[model samples]
Target: MDVLLTVVVPVYAVEGYLYQCLESIRAGLTAEENAQVEVIAVDDASPDSCGLMLDGYATRHGDLRVVHLTSNVGLGLARNAGLVEARGKYVWFVDSDDWLPSGSIRAVLDKLRETEPDVLLIDHLRVHENGRLQTDASSPMLRGTVTLDRLLAVQHTAWNRIMRRDFLTKHDLRFPAGWYEDVPFSNPVLLAAERVEVLDRVCYHYRVGRFGAITATRSERHFEAFEQWDRLYAWLDATGVDQALRIRLFTLMISHLLVVAGNDSRVHPRRRRQFFRRIAGLYRRHRPEGYQPPVGTPGIKHRLVAINSYAMYSALRTGYRVAGLRRRSTERTPVVSQDLPSAPQRVQTTSLR
Candidate 1:
């Protein structure tokens, strides 16, 4: 039978939630769609029962297959391995820790047939430990019709998206083995796609503030994000995107730096200066013509960076610490990528939390 979609699940140390993820996948696909759907679950050397659990599930479902890796490879490489075995016309990358809503796969398959796009973007809900579900505001681009110009404002995330296998192969896209690898892998493909569609329906649940989640951990490995940004720039330069797209991409890059150096509480307070300096250097290196930061916190950081005012940056950051204002850049520093934890601040679990 011809396969309609191949779901690639990369598992690593997600044993606690792996069962829910896999179960969601199984239940979402109706029995009628069973033959048309296949799952490629990669156990990336998880030192837990995940591999065994996957094997057990595979035994029950002939359409589901599990690949056991001999050694521990990061998420990016594990995804690359899954791509090697994908045999469907469309490929969906589902994180092992996250699950899809009921009947999402069938809905997505219907949407795919509606317009065979190069990529289909689905809406996602961020679920916190407290059971708080955050559905982002309705997007104009996702509604009615979308254009590349409008998509410039939309962020490119790896998950909650389905890509044509041939489109990905044509672009020769591969996930890099490092932190924030999504930047390089997703951005280029999104920009290169001739037909991109965004669905407003929430299909996936992205969990935050969950124990053992990669995002929940703060460490120097976060600095690897900078390398990811550099890779993104290199790809953009090589592909020769239009000037408008280049400016938009640069704007997002600048915004990421501002968020990391200013508002992200994961950064160590001692390393805030280094983070600021790095952001400054990036802006200087990649600032495109007619570049102006978006109004608000990011714009403030841009003004400070323009003047090379580290003193202003420090003073503003200190104000945020003392005033206890959220969403303001220059939060208690260390920015995880620094390879150090915040000495002044440790994990604080409050009653409300």
Candidate 2:
């Protein structure tokens, strides 16, 4: 029988949590749901024992398949590999460190069967280090069909959603292998989607570990985020996505850059200033002729900082330099807590896919 859904999991150095993630998959899908489920776990040459564990799981589970990568390609490439190999009508990408709630697949499939939407957004819980679960207020975005403009105005994480494989393939939608890759890929998908459904039920549990992820490292790779944003803006202008939608998209992009720049204490003052200036210039250059700032109760500090542009950048630089100096003088390590429960091991099974 044809598969109903293909869940693509990109594994990389997540050996500690891989078993738990796979077990969540097995336990989450009911027998009927399991019959329609096909899991494609792509191991991106994880330096840890994750590849071995994945291989073991494939050997035991009939529904699980493992793809071993020779080199460490980024998450975008790993996800793309899974996408190309997927045979399900619907595709869902889950990070190896994250897991879906029980019956999540069946819930998504039920929505897909009823709405037949190009994309389905589902709510997710952000699991913190204290083992506390926070209901993301942004969860409502998964409730029903929404326009591209509306979706862009809120959160924009690519995970926690189910998408039709045909829709993605037809539009050539693939994640860009760079920092903040979602910005470029997801915007276009949103614009191209004919229909989108938002499921109110929480399906994904996002584990926010205390240990920083790739995004925490500030390096040349982080600069790639700017390139991704530029490409997205160019695409919007060239394709002429609804003018209103374009405005919202532009505002959101600028807002995101401002927040990042303001929060980054590692950026040099000169570089930070340059970054803000560039963003402000882009805003002034591309904003449509009658563009007016939205009036709200109060603008966020980052948004306010973005308004000054250069000044904000300079301030960030100064703060970063002081923080760096302080760190050098103190020779002290900050205390951090790691209190989340350990992921459970999985029962190995043979491949059924």
Candidate 3:
């Protein structure tokens, strides 16, 4: 039987999580079901023993294939390497630091058989360090509709979506190297896809707040977010996506940039002002004519950004941060706080490990 899905996991220093991640791929599936799935774990020259561990695991499990790179490439290029080795009809990129839920493989296979969509969007929950599970804020929005605007509105993580191999290859949709690489790759796949389906069930568990994890750590590389978005902007101009769609994308871009700039975890306090100014520069260059900002606090932010008011924005951020701290102290549940405009979750293009 031919492989129906190829699961590509880019592994770096995820020694603690790699075992569970690989095991989850075959957890609830029978031998026959497992036969129809190909697992490729790319060891991106991990500094730990992950490469050696992968070799041993592949030897013990005949179906698992391991790719050992000579040097550490970031997450985007590592996934691209795994894509080249995939032979299945469809491909799913699973992060090594995360794992699939039980029976997810069977669920995905069944969905693919039923819909045969060029792109399949799946729901996921954010798994906190304290064992709390919070549904992705965008989960409710994932439905039968496959419009480009709706697709763009959903979270931009690659792991939450499964794509047909031929569709990706035909469009030459490979991830670019740098942070926020998903910005360029995920949007274009959705835009070019002819058929799309959504599996509303939670198929994956996204690990959050893990020590040394990409989304959790502070890094100057967050600046790459602007360049990555620029890549998509270039694509939009080249493809001549409709003016309305361009506006929608532009709105999303501002929201995403604000999220990054205001995020204390991603951008350091010292560099926050610089990041905000850079975002304001982007706003001036790309803000659509006659564009109306969204309502509420986010709208206020858009208006502030329009005038390049970093001082005002910083004051507003201070207020939000104070309010968020109060809420956190009162609430016991481990909730991921969102104090900025509604946008896709901030994803790191580098290895989560």
Best by TM-score: 3
The runs of at least 3 residues in candidate 1 whose Cα sits more than 4 Å from the true structure, single-residue gaps closed, are: 137-141, 263-265, 321-353
Clashing pairs in 3: none
Local accuracy of candidate 3 as per-residue lDDT tens digits, 221-254: 9999989988998898788788888788888889
CA RMSD for every model?
9.5, 7.4, 6.4
Model 3, position 195: C-alpha lDDT score: 84
Per-residue lDDT of model 1, residues 232-342, tens digit only: 999988988888888888887877766666544456667767777777888788888988777986688788987778899788868867777555555666533222111
How do all the candidates rank in terms of TM-score, highest first?
A: 3, 1, 2
lDDT to native, each model: 0.77, 0.72, 0.85
Against the correct fold, how does model 2 do in TM-score? 0.81
Q: What tens-digit string does per-residue lDDT give for candidate 2 at 48-138?
A: 8988898888888766889999999888889999999999999999988888777667677877777778877777778876777776765
Model 2 lDDT at residue 294 = 60
TM-score winner, 2 or 3: 3
TM-score of 1: 0.87
